[model samples]
Target: MLLKSPWKPRLADTEATVAERLVQALADDIAAGTLETGDRLPAHRELAWALEIGIGTVTKAYAILERRGLVRGVKGRGTFVAAYQARQGTLIDLSINAPPPILSHRALARSLMAISRKVDADYFTLYASPAGHLEHRRLLARWLETLGLVADPARLVLTGGAQQALALAFDLVCGRDGVILTERLTYPGAITLCRHTGLRMRGVAIDDEGMVPSSLAEALDSEGTSRRRAVYVTPTLHNPTTATMTLARREAIADICRLHDVPIIEDGVYGSGTEGTPIAMLAPERCLHVSSLSKTISPGLRVGVLLVTPAMECLATTALQALPFSPSPLSCCVIEDWLANGTIRSVRLELKREAARRSELAKALLADRTLVSHPDAYQAWLPMPREEADMFASSAASLGIAVTPPSAVMVAPEESDSGVRLCLGGASFDDLTRALSLLSGIGRSTRPL
Candidate 1:
C-alpha cells in the first residue's frame, strides 16, 4: 500500500504555511523514494477538502512551489513533483518590537565623556537609592512635565526597563488571588507577568477608541472592588493595534476606575514620537504611567521611568527594593545627561520623522489589506482569518522573514485576533521595504473563491 501522506500538520509547532507544509512533505517524500518524480499530487480542492482546510491555502502553497521549481501544473492534468532548489540567507526579523537603532554615536560618546568629567566619579562607586537618586528623579520630573504632568521627584521610580517597571508596579499593588482587568489584547509582557505571578487577568471589551467604559464597569462590578487590583492600558500608540484612547475616553475610564477604587497601570512605551494627553494627567491619584527610552532611543540603554502619586510612592519604592537590581547607575548617568543637555529632545524629534517614514512605507505597500496603525507608531496590524494569517505568517517565517502572529500578543487566547503585527521600526528602511514587498506579494496572491 502507498505510504499515508504527511501533509496533515500539527501547526502548534510547524512554522511552514499549511500549503507550504504540504509542499515540503511532498518534497521529502519524493527524496525518500515514497513518491517518484513523475507522481501526481492530489487535486487542489480535493486535497483541501481532505485536509479540512481552505482551497485558497492550498492554492497559495502550490503557487509558491511552482515558482521555486518544486512543482509543475498542467491545464487538465493535476500538479506533479518537480526539482526543488534550496533558498539561502539570514532570516529577516519582523517579529520583534525593537525599533531600528538610530542613536547618534557621537552624541552618546560626548555624553559619556561629559559624565566622566563634570560629574563626581564617587557617585558611580555608590549604590543608587532604591527608587532612584534624588537629582536624577528631579530631572525625570522635569521631563514628565513636558508630557503634561507636573511630576514630583518622590513620585517617580526608576527601573532597569519598562518590563521591570511594570512588574514592580503590579507586584506592589496586587495581592494574591487578585484579578487585573485590561484591554482584550495587550502587550505580551503584561500577560507573561500576570501568569508568572499567579494573578488572574480578565480582558475587557474594546472599540476603536479603547477599552469600552461599559465593559470596564461591568467587569469591575462582577469582580467586586476587593479582588480587582488594577486596570492596565497602553493609552498611546497601543502595541500590536495602534488604538490611542481619546481624552474623553481616558476621562470616562478614569471615572469608572475611581468609582470602583481600581488603579490604572498605563503603558506608554511607544509614546516617544506620538502626542496624546495621558490618563495620569487626568487622574494622578489613580494612575501609574510606565514608559521607556527603548523605542525612541537605543534599547541597549535600558532606562525606564514610572510616574505615581505621592500617596502611592512608598508602596512603589518597596516594590523597587524587592527586585534584585535597581536602576543601572551607568544608564541613569546617560539618561540624566541626555535629559539635562537637550540631547534626548533633539533625538526624539529626528526619530519621530523616521517612525513616520516607516509607517508610510507600510501604508503604501499594504493599503489593500485591513490595516490598523498610527502614522507615528512603530507597528501596524493586519486583520486576516486566524488560520489563514497564521499560515501566512509561518510561510513568511519559512521564507526567512519573521512577522508576529496575532496569538502571540492576544490577552485572551481563545478570543480570536485573526491577524499579524507588522513591526515597521525593527529593520532598516531597505530591509523593511524588501520584507514588505514579499508580504504584499502574499496579499496580492490570487485566492480561490
Candidate 2:
C-alpha cells in the first residue's frame, strides 16, 4: 500500500533535461515550504507513472536529493523529506574559514550614518598617497599598540585586505626567483601567491607548536646564502593546524632567519592580540607583520595593515605604488572611526564570545576524534593521512556538509602530514552541530566511502 504524495510539481519549461528539471522542481517545492519535513514522497514507480517520465529519472532525482540532505530513505519505509529541508537546508558550507557574524544590521547602519556625517566630499574624491593617508596610518599604529605591536606610522602601508598585504610582503622579501619557506601545511593564499609570482615555495616540518625551528634552519641552509629568500610563518593560531608557537620557538625561528640573512613575513591574520608575542617583535629588523580586520570585525570590510622595518619601508611603499590603485579611502575612514570610537574593541569582544561558543560546540561534538582547535579560533583541523582525509571529505560533502580538503591546505603535494580543515565559524550553530555530528559518525567508520 503506497501512501499518496501530494506533490505534483510541473517541471520548468527550460533547456534542462528531464532529470534536472525534476530535481529543480522538487528543490523549489522543498525551499518554498510546499514539501515539508516528514512528508512522504510518492514511490519511484508512482512518481514516474504520474510524470510520464522514465523510472530511472525519478530514481536519479531521489538519489540527488538524498545526497543533498534534502530527503532521506528508511530501510523498510519509503523515502521522506529530511528534517534539514524544513530549516534552510540548501548547503551547510563548512569550507569558508571566517569568523561568525556578531555585528547587527542596526549597528552597521548607525556606523555608516555616522561616517557620512563626519566626512566631506573630498574624503571620497581626493587621491591619497600610496602608503595611505597620514591620519589613517596613525590610527592603525595606535590600534596595533593595544596588541603589543609598537608600530611606527611611517613604516605602515595600508592595503586592500590581508591578501594584498601578503602580496606586498612577498614582494618586499622575495623577488621573482626567490624561495619561500613555510610550514608543511600553510594558508592557501600563500600557495596561490607563490605560484602567481613564480616564487619557489618549500615546505618545512611543523609540529604542535607551529613551524619546527630545526626544519626551518635546514630549509634555509639548503637555499644557500646567494639565493634571495624569505620565511613566512603564522606563529599565532596557524591556519590549518591551529598551532600557536611558544615564545622559545619564535625566538629560535627568528634566530635562524637572522643567521641566514633572510627576511621573515609573519602573517597574523588569525591572531586576536592574545596569542603570544609576534615573531616580528623578536626579529623587528627583518620581519614584516601583516594583519587585517576581516576575521575579527567584518569580512566585507576590506582594510589591512602591513608593518615593515625602516629599511624595507621605502621598498614596501614602492611596491604599494606599483599596484594599479590603493585601498578604498572610504573603507579606511570606516576603520578609523571604528578604531577611534572603540567600536572595533566592542565587536572583538562579541566575536570572542561567539567564536568561543562555536569552538566549544565543535570540541564537544568531535571530542573523541583527534581535533586541533583553539578557544578563540574559528577553524579546526582533523589530522589524518592523505587517502583517509580525501575519503572523509568526500563523504561529508555527499551529505551536504562542505569541508576544506587536505590538498587545499597542504604546502607540498606529497607532504606526509595532511588533513582536512573544518571551518566552524561560517555555519549557524544548529547547522554546525548537525554537521559535526555527521562528521563524527563518518570518522568512526573504517571506510567512509
Candidate 3:
C-alpha cells in the first residue's frame, strides 16, 4: 500500500525559520476559512510534528498569534480560536470611499444651531423645491469664487450629493444609447449610471499623470463608429491612486476635449484640499463641475452643488426636473449659513489637520513599504510582491481589517494587477491607529505559499 505523505505547509522562500512557518500555517488556515470563528485548533506539539517543525518554534508562533488575539490558551485544555477572534476581522477597507471623521468645531456647531433657530419650520418642511434655497445658491457661489471657479448663483442647482449630480449630468448630456469616454479605472458609480441609462461607456488609457492625451485622441478619432459625447475625470487628488495631474496635462486634456467638441464632467470632490485653480477654472465654458460638502464637511448633509456654463443653465434646470422635486432645504440652509458665517473655513481647517495626522500615521506605519498616496489624501495604494494581493486582503480581513484588492477597483475587468487600496480617513484616530498597527504587523509577518 502506498503511504500517505505527512502534512506539510507551503512556505515563502524568504521565511525559513520554523516559527515563521508555523505562523504562516495559522494565517493560511484562517484565510482559507478552515480554522473558522470558534473552531478549535490542534495542540501545539501535534501541529508542529505534523508540519515537521520544532516544538519551541510552535510555542513562539502561538504566543505571537495570542498577542494578536487570533487564538486562546487554557491551563488544562489545548489552544483554540479565541472567543474574541470574530472582533479582530479585516482592516484597511478600500471598497467604500468615505471621508475622515469631521473634527468637531464648536464655532461651526454654534453657527448651524443659530441657523436652525431662525428657520421657523422643521428641516423636512423646507425641502419642497428641487431648485434648493436661493440663499444656499448664493453662498455656494461665494465658495466657488474662493476656489477660483466663478459662477452665477442663479445658475447653480443643488442635488442630494455628487452621485446625484453626476446622474443629473448624465440625464442632460446623454440620451438613450449615447456614448461617454472615461479613464480605464474610473469611478464605478459613473459606470453604473451609464448602464442604468442605456448609455455606452468607452474606456480610455491613463498614464501616471492621468488619462493619456493619445488615448483620448484615439477614442475621439473613432467618432463616426463610437460617437463619444462626454469625458469624465477626477483631475485633482484622484481617487484610488491619489494622482494629481499637472497644469500642463490638464490643459492638454482640455484642448483635446475642445477639439473633439466633447463636454468634460470634472469631479472636484477631492479638490478642496488641494491649493490650485481647478481644471474647471481653465475650461469653464465647456466643463460641468460637480462638487460636494461631504468630503470637506459632513457626508450626512448630502448636498451636491453643480456649476454649469451660463448657456447650459436651461439644460441643468431641465435635468433637475427629473430628480427629486427638490433638495433638502434644511441641508442647503445649513451649508449656506456655514459658508456665509465663516463656519466653512473653520471646518476646512479641521479637515486639513485630521488629514495631515492620518497621512502621517499611514506613512509611519508603512515606512519602507511601497505605497502611493498624498499627504492630504484619504487613502493609499499599495503594490505587493507576487499576486498575493487577495491573500493579503483575506489575512487582513481575518484580523478585523477591511481592504480592497486590485480587482475591486479595476477600470477594465480584463486587466489584472498586484495591488490594493487602503483607506485611512473613515474611522476615529484611535481606531485608525489600531488598524494601522495591525496592518504594519501583517506587512512584517511571513507569507505562506
Candidate 4:
C-alpha cells in the first residue's frame, strides 16, 4: 500500500507572501491535530519542492513558526515540532469588538432564576411572532426614549441580533445585484454581508467630522435618481474610524438621500457613546434604524430592535419570517426584568463610564503617537505608512496581541488606509494598559518594512 504523504500543505492561494501562507498552513494543521506532537514537518527543500515554491520561502516559513513557538529548529537534527502553542504567554485579545460584560455571573444567575419563577413556562417554551411579543416591542420603544427617539411599537421588529436586522434592512432596500453607498471605511459586518448579497458598494470620502456630504451627494448624483441605491452609515462612533458626524452633517446626508429617494440604513449598534438623534430620526420617511443590546448588555442575550418606516415595516417582518426568525424567549424575559428593575439603564451607565475610562487610557498610552478616536469611543484608528502596514500588523500578531486590520474595514482597495483599529473593550483594564504600552512601542518603531 502507498504510504500517507508527509505533511501536504493545502494552503489557500492569496496575496499574503508564500512564507506567511506556509506558516498559516502548518499552524492550522497543528491546531487540528493532523500534525501530531512529535511528527516532524517536511524539510525546507522537500516542502519547497512539494509546494513548487522557492526553498528560501520555506526557510522563512519555518523561522516564523519557530518564533511563534509552534516548532523548533533542531540544528543538524533538522527542525522538529516543539509544542502546539506556548501556554505561558498572556494573549491580550484586543481583536474582538464587543462590550465587556459588566455584570457578575452570580448576579446574572440570580436575575435569571428570579425571572423563571415570575414568567409562565408555556410563554417561554412557545415561539414568539416573527416581530416578537407586542409588549417586548413597546418596551423597546420606551427604551429608545432615552436615546431621544419616540418610536412607535407598530413600526418596530425584534431581531436575533444587529446582523439579522441589518440583513433584513439590506434585503428590503436592495435587490439582486444592488448597489449600496457607504463611507470609505465602515463596519466589517456590513462588508461581509454585502459580499453574500451581491451588493456592490460605492465609497464616499470622510473628514474628521465623518463622511463628507459633498462626496455622498456626488456619488448619489452619479448613480442617478432612478438607481436602486441605499446608503449605510454608522453616524456616531463610526466603526474603525471613530469619526462621529455632527448633527448638521447628518442632516446634509439626509437631504441628499431624500432628494434621490434613496433609502438609508442606520447602524445604531454602538449607541452607547453616541450623541444627538439617529439619522433615522432626521429622515424618518426613508430610513431603517437598527439597534442591539449586544454592545451594551451581553451578546448572549442576542436581542436587537429595528425602527423601520411604517410603510416598509412589513418588509422587515417578511424578511424575518423568510429567515425563520425565532427570538430567544429566555433573553427577552431577561430584558423584561432588566428594563422593569432599572437594571438595563444601570448597566448602560456602568458600561459608558468604563468605555470612557478605557478610551482615556488608550489616548494617554499613545499620547506621543497618532490615534484617531472619540473620547467616548471603544476603539481608536491608527493610520500607518502604506508600505509599512503589512510588517507592522504581522509583527504585532506574532507578538500575541490582536487588532482589526485595515482590509477588514475598507470597502475599496484604493480606500485601504494602511492601519489598524485598536479596540479598547473585551480585555481587562490591566491587560488593556499592558497591551497599549506594547502597541505604542511597536507603533513608534519606524524600522524598514
Best by TM-score: 4
Off by over 4 Å in 2: 1-88, 446-449
Score every model by TM-score: 0.81, 0.80, 0.76, 0.83
The list of candidate 4 runs beyond 4 A from truth reads 1-87, 225-227, 414-416, 446-449
Clashing residue pairs in candidate 2 are none
lDDT of 2 by residue, 191-255 (tens): 88898899988999989998999989888877786768889999988998889988999999999
**Comparing 1 and 4 on lDDT, the stronger one:** 4
Q: For candidate 1, what is the TM-score?
A: 0.81
Q: After superposition, how far is residue 228 of candidate 4 from its true place, in Å?
A: 2.2
Cα error of candidate 1 at position 105, Å: 2.9
In Å, residue 171's CA in model 1 sits off its true spot by 1.2
Across 1-449, the per-residue lDDT of candidate 1 in tens digits comes to: 33334343322323334665665555445444455555677777777887788989878877765654456887777787664321256667788887666776787788899988778565577777888778778877777776666778888887778998888778766865778899887787888888888999889887787789999999888887667478998888877788888888888999998898888998978775236788888888888888787766777878788887668877776665666435677787787788878888887777778888988888898888878878778888886665556556645654457788666676766564557888888788888998888788667442222
Residue-level lDDT tens digits of model 4 in 382-430: 8775334544554455456667756667787454355678888889898
The better candidate by lDDT, 1 or 3, is 1
Ranking by TM-score: 4, 1, 2, 3
lDDT per residue (tens digit) for residues 1-449 in model 3: 22222334444332135565466567656654567656666666777677777778778877766765567887766676654343344444545667776746775578677876787464455453456667668777887776667777887787788888887776666667678787776666786677678887777887677788889989888865454388888887776678788888888889998887788888888777345667777887888888887766776778887877677888777666675634677777777777767777877777777777888888898896787878777888786642355456645767667776554455554454546788777877787888777777777452433
Considering every candidate listed, which one attains the maximal lDDT?
A: 2
Model 1, 66: alpha-carbon shift in Å?
A: 14
